[model samples]
Target: MTAEFAVALPSVILLLALLLAGSAAGVTQLRVEEAARGGARALARGAAVGEVGDIVRRLAGETARSEVALDGEWGRVTVTGRVPGAVGTLVPWVLSATAWARPEAPGAAIQPAVDGTSREARLGT
Candidate 1:
């Protein structure tokens, strides 16, 4: 029994460690995706590229990096961050996410519906 226990212990511990590392990587990936989405939204709202980068960093981690591209009415943001943990280091896991949005012109306001009734008016707000 002792021999069997000794043989299984290391395997169990290694499995647990791998599970933790995988979960950490998944969480980091979610953060990267969220950062990209937020950056895209900010860019679509006419925010400066620097501000979008800041938003991405804030939503992700300080070590995270972002890229922004604007082409005509389209905007794209990509965010990348390193996963945290020894396993991540061993595997060199780098998580990235990209999001796209249609940017409005600077100083352009949201247009009302075709019937000329505002959303608030329809909702009685």
Candidate 2:
């Protein structure tokens, strides 16, 4: 019995390590997706591009990438990053995700200023 147990212990450990690797990758993917959606929403609401990037970096680490582009009324955000797991030496794939959002309206993003005028007005139309 002892010899059989010893023979199976390595297999058990390897299986457990694989499970941990999968869990880590899943968690990283979810985090990246969340950051992408949040950043996209903020951008659609008129937030600065730098701010959107900051939000993604803060949530998903410095290696993560974020981009926002406008298509008339819609915005798309893509987030990508590498997630190393418990068995990084053996994992050969990259994990990534993307999300999209649309602006509420044309002038909806315009903010009112202290001078009783819209920011768009201050910007000269």
Candidate 3:
């Protein structure tokens, strides 16, 4: 019995450690995805190019690094992030996540047009 237990113990420990590592990786992936989503949304909303990058970097923080790309003509934003992990033996692993969103065009926003006289009446001064 002792011999069998000794043989199995290492395997069990390794399995548990791998499971924990996998869980940590999954959590990090979630954070990466969230950061990507936030970046895409910011870009979609017409944030400046530099500001979009800043927002993505801040959202990713130290655990991850992110990049944001924008397509002004198509109103599209893409965000990518890499998540780092140590699965075993102090070796690092990287997981990546990406998100995209398209912003509505300016022409889509409808507003009531008012001529000078109507504008004055609406002001009701």
Per lDDT, the best of the predicted structures is: 1
**Which digits, one per residue and each the tens of the lDDT, describe model 2 over residues 8-121?**
999999899888888878888888888888877776787666677788888777777776555555556677767675475476656666676666675654222235332211
Question: Which regions of candidate 2 fall more than 4 Å away from where they truly are?
Answer: 108-125
lDDT value for model 2: 0.67
- For residues 1-125, what per-residue lDDT tens digits would candidate 1 score against the true structure? 99999999999999999999989999999999999999888877877666777788889988888876555467678788899888888898889898988756765543322344322111100
Report the poorest 10 consecutive residues by lDDT, candidate 2. Answer: 116-125
Candidate 1 at residue 35, lDDT? 94
Candidate 3 Cα lDDT to native? 0.54
Query: Residue 112 lDDT in model 1?
Result: 26
- What is the per-residue lDDT of model 3 for residues 13-33, given as tens digits with 9 covering 90 to 100? 999988888777677667667
List lDDT for all candidates, in order. 0.76, 0.67, 0.54
Each prediction's TM-score versus the true structure = 0.81, 0.76, 0.64
